[model samples]
Target: MTLQQRQLAADTPTRFARALAVTISLGCAALASMLLAEAAARDGFSGWDGIRAVLVFVTTAWLAWGASLALIGLFGGRTTALRPDLHAPQPRTVIAVPICNEDPLTTFARIAAIDRSVARADVTADFVVLSDTRDDGLAGKEQFAFARLLRETDGAGRIFYRRRRDNSGRKAGNIEEFIRTSGGAYELAVILDADSLMEGDTVRAMIARMQSDPQLGLLQTLPKIIGARSFFGRALQFASWFHGPIFTRGLARMQGPTGPFWGHNAIIRVQAFAESCALPELSGPPPLGGHILSHDYVEAALLARAGWKVEVDETLGGSFEEGPENVLSFARRERRWCQGNLQHSRLIFAPGLAGWSRFVFLQNVTAYVVSLLWAAFLVTSAISTLYAPPPEYFPGPYQLFPVFPDTSTREITLLALGVLGLLVVPKMLILLHAILLDRARDFGRSLRMALSVLTEIILTTLLAPLMLLYHSRAVVQVLSGQDGGWPANQRNEGQLSLCDGWAAGYWIVLVGAAIIAAVQWLAPDLTIWLLPVAVPMLFAPFLIAWTSLPLNRVLFAVPEDAAPLDVVTEYDSICDVWRLTWNDEHLMPKATSPDLTHATA
Candidate 1:
């Protein structure tokens, strides 16, 4: 370890914090495994039961690790601040917004709003639209929009737009190209997605932090979901508003120097990034080979390897991004992410990566793998029951697999309940913590926040099976060598008709029906027990359509709306005026974003 990292490690509580989190996770996993193994060993402990026990450990460990992070944040108290929250930005910072097959009007208006924000703050920052758009028709629209945007924002030299005809490397490549060509002019770069938005103050804050610490290579801010209108969208917004911070805080405490970079809504030292974050194509073919899929995580690891501090600051607000308004869009994005993460398996042994960075890759892979493991466990459970032998009432002392004297039903019920508790308890605690700390009033008082939490929990619970199926499919596709290519995200009007939902989810329905039919004939007794898992799948199409519909803001009114950020309000006003103009000219479709409409109202 370098002297700087050693000092930071010694000064910070990252070691103790990580150790505690892991110990808690492992302890819970081991206990749950023993209980599950005892419960499954009812008729006879077969090789299948042993295999299940191992799977249970891995799956439970993943769940418990997540819960532990939140628990740590709840009790861990005050995380250390590495930067002094500097306010003055010394040199010009380029705001690089990477785009590919996106809405030009909505995209350019954002640039206008952000330009106004920086101009208002009197901070020296430039906006660069690094376009990787492929469609010729859309490329022309981008030109028109860029011209109009320049006129609207009076951005002659301050704002720039460029589209690459040869879009080879995608988003990462887009950013890298800019750095290679125009990066020398700027000292700092604030990278953002096409949908990402940030307040002038927040940009100043991140720049100040970077300026304050020369060793800081990258600074990531927690980008909250904004402008979500649909039911699924609002639920996500609430979860991010209510639950995201706690988890983010926990992660922030542990990620001392080698913290994460989530691609966008972050600031990076141009020199450091240019020198350290260049990625090489991995040897071999597609899926697990070729170009790195999730380049942000790899870049963070590389920066750390180069002896630069990479940190995430969740406390900084005014950073925001739009999300897919429906489950289909969300799943499509998740599928791409799954492939990206699984592709990292090849880099686990890549030399010079920090231990945590290596573990981060494993964590990503296991996240999807746990769903598969759960699927495997269920299948194994059914087989073990089918081939049951006479119960071993008299087992040897100090047996490797315990044979319980009591009814296995009770043990199994307890184990199941424990797993559910692990999934739920942390969220309930976060809500309680919010109330106790007087933070719940921000979301229209404790009562409404309570309702939001309950409603979100119930909704997420119903949707869990569908999401599990989606993730399982993603893992299978990646493993079977199917590349989930860069799919364009659906950012606006996320509603899905029943037909559309059905078209997307018919296979899920079929899979659910198949499981139920298989179990009804083979294991008649367990048929009722499996309804919770199967019923959701059967109704997934309807659920998807339902959740995609818009919801009243009364229920999920965000704290951000309570006191609007400068950038958010600016963007909304610009959107309202632009929509008015577009609708008048009959050149664009109407229906301004709900978040924008609500804020403007």
Candidate 2:
């Protein structure tokens, strides 16, 4: 480490800033809870009203805490001053891409693109393709694709591929195995998902950051979503390109010295990770107990516990990852994440964890837990309206004319508006910032940006209930000891048929119908208020199917859709070549590498 880097690592975030983040986050949540309690009491109090008020407090507090982060991100200081100089010496780094049953052609093509990018920058980095594919046929295909990658990029020595027979610990195990065998050769490792693509300069910049902060264990980059074609994917792309920066910046500020590792598309110090991140399995069986499924968070916590800084650099760009193209695909991914996050419940109180690390576990826990809470709130509100007695305005010995009850509709409306503001103002602030900074052009300019935001809001709102149900189910299943086993990501897969979409979402739609019917039969007056939540449930299937289709992608077009990235364009061509030409008998040249000749032999 350089003298300057060592000096800077000595100065972490001040206690005052950490306290401020906690104060603002909790303080806002507390104030929002107080307001919700007051609003609930505006109508004469009841036990049911009290329950509603409590749920309101918990849910709104969660929202407020998020808002606080974004606000801090907007107004907080940055680490730009601590950034490493570009002309400084570089370190030896290994870029690791973990792949399972993925499309070998597309995955290796992406690696080729990344390898070329790194080669162009003249950086001393090796790329490794670690495969955990259990299927022999798919593994063979991956080997052939790796050979193609080697031939095409002329990366025989610099790029390597290895597949494991037993997919024991999944991606985490794959990485750990690499670290044990080959990690000694490099100072740092840039971990990437199969779909990850980092520009050569971004890779160099991240390495520089690591070199500048010797105590920095991991530096996560905010990767913009690329190559999205469906409406769902495009919306995500636009959000990531535009609003994602603000969110990540806020998270970075609040995280200070202890940020997060999102498993891939980030750089990590080899020595620190190897020493601190050897994950331990919790004793027991499936879902709730076993090997740590979400190993990234635990690894970060371990690093912080060992007094290493894990920070995220949101200002750095040119890193990219693909998103699921449709809602069902997204739900499938979320199902796995849901189990992983829920699994952290057991580790929340693990010994010697930093306070912030523990809080992060809670944050992951809340991400899915809030959906259940929201669902419960809806159910309780329905029950309260149906079975609970009418408001007792004359509870006391009031002598005068019996007081009349009022729902305080105006106050309720304003409260709803306040809650909406908390939920959306951060996004508005992001939009305003982009416009003011002239960054709106990156999202297709102000007019289209506004339209895209509007479309995203509508689509997300319609899809929220479905997600809530999906998440709620996943959590319940996990809690009931059902494990969501490792599933390969179906990147950019075809759309589900209407029947398939319906099959995936029938339970959700049925529950929505049941809730609406129950509400209408018990309390007709409350049905209107319930429509916002209930209507989405009924239309869940249609929403999933519609968003899954390639149609309407142009309607909410993203900047990438309008003008594609070079890597994305190249990847498409490579996919066509592999798909159409792989089966041709003589595609492989006569005198290939010995390893390739032997593997195919």
Candidate 3:
């Protein structure tokens, strides 16, 4: 029942709506660029002014685009629901959990929970643990964990484990290997990462949707963050729970059939994926050349190219994931993604790609490229200021008076407000939307939700400079041909100490101090303007460590915190009981690492 291309037209927005969104974004960008150019040209137009104008145009467009999406979600409302055939006999399905150097205990527990969850929903599905773990010691522990998991779930035959000798292709390659060998056994595969967990009913619901829509090749669920204990982590959870859906709803609306694939927490038609997504290695060396690091987005584009509907349903709930506990972990994850995205520059012109696919790649690249432009703008400004000509009093014929240049202070203020508005107005509007619709109840009622939003806004504002520095560095590293090898994610990277934060962030501190000193000495007028960004960097280690420290968990509370989902509660209980079992049997001693199940649980 492959859906025809014409059938998708009914679901897409009118050309007018899409056109209007682009119009709004570009218009905002244009005006902001104009304001910047005027301010820069007050003394005299220079190359630095031109560069600054272009940078502002690109970055403001992105910011405005983001604000536009939120507005679209707020106004356009939720997507029209596609009815599913829910009570029908479930299809042959396999929940594939991918792991690489992840904790065997916590990782396996998530699988066991998912296995038991599906069973409880009266849905029959096999669970597979695809391990690309490289450490021999970790591999030995994984086998023990698998045995324990099988025993606990009584999934001796239902659950399976396979470790690859050489994980050459990374995650995409790992999955490709699985499909190459065992994909034909199942019609649908629920792909999951080591940190991913979903409610039984959510999984069942997705399958139903796939069953109902023969044209649908993949369905992505909005996975919420859970199990956060640190301040930074909880803020991420709250924002995802609150702001993420509205933005995602807008994304889904705009995407129609050409949606996104975030690699995991998605269900795909195995046959469609196999036939369409045989990714080719680009013509080059490492970084830009080797196997594609970010394969999910490409897979979605491929599926769309093959006439399959790729969609994201933001309304569907119960999908879950974890976030980095601190800035360091986040930076590490972001660096790899940076490389993955910049690699897309090569594929932007690849043959047979859809127009939207190319645009999406452009957006991805622009997101990081904007950071470089910004850094360049600042450098150019510094250089220009250092060698600026002194104010001159010119006589038309023989006048003895010096004329001072207008600072265009008002223009500068207006431009700052416009840029600030793009960032703040969306969050404020979303807050108002929450109040109007009484959606705050979902985030622990109005007062706490409002407080959470306030804290998140402030915290994120403080972290902006840090992120800017990291993004710029990552882009530079990729350009320099540095390879950020495939490193396994440390899902439980716990509290970072001051020393640890300092170790990772000292360079930033130095940079910050240097910027402030140079600005104060060379450009006294700009010293006040740079304080907000410089202050945070000067205290980067403190900010990072403090955010990572264990918090009360009462303020930045999400829906999951207030009322744990059935699957989450069950997962915790199972882990507790299993840890006790391991301790009693002395399988993993308590004297080992702090994160070892036997020691912590």
Clashing pairs in 2: none
Q: Candidate 2: lDDT of 560?
A: 66
**For model 1, how does the per-residue alpha-carbon lDDT over 1-601 read when each residue is reduced to its tens digit?**
7775554342347878788889989998999899988887656678888988998898889889999889877887355554455454367799999887677778888888888887776678988998887777667777777888899878899899998978766778788999999999999999988888888878888888888888889999989999899998998998888888888888877776888999999999999999988788878777877778788999998988788888888888888998778998888888888888898888888887778888888887888878888888778877777887655755887678767555687777887888888889999999899999999778889888889888888898888889989999999998998887776665465778999989999999999999899998888777777888889999999999999998987787689868878888988899888766763243332334222111000
Q: lDDT by residue for model 3 over 337-378, one digit each (tens)?
A: 888888888878877666677778888788887778766766
Per-prediction TM-score: 0.93, 0.90, 0.94
- Among all windows of 10 consecutive residues in model 1, the one with the lowest summed lDDT is 592-601
- On TM-score, the candidate that comes out on top is 3
In order, candidate lDDTs are 0.82, 0.77, 0.82
Which regions in candidate 1 have their CA more than 4 angstroms from the true location? 1-12, 77-89, 390-406, 582-601
- Name the regions of candidate 3 deviating beyond 4 angstroms: 1-17, 386-389, 393-403, 583-601
Per-residue lDDT of 426 in model 3: 89
Best candidate, lDDT: 1
Candidate 1 versus the native: TM-score?
0.93
Off by over 4 Å in 2: 1-44, 77-83, 86-89, 391-403, 551-566, 576-601
- Backbone clashes under 3 angstroms, per model: 0, 0, 1
lDDT of the structure predicted as candidate 2: 0.77
Better of 1 and 2 by TM-score: 1
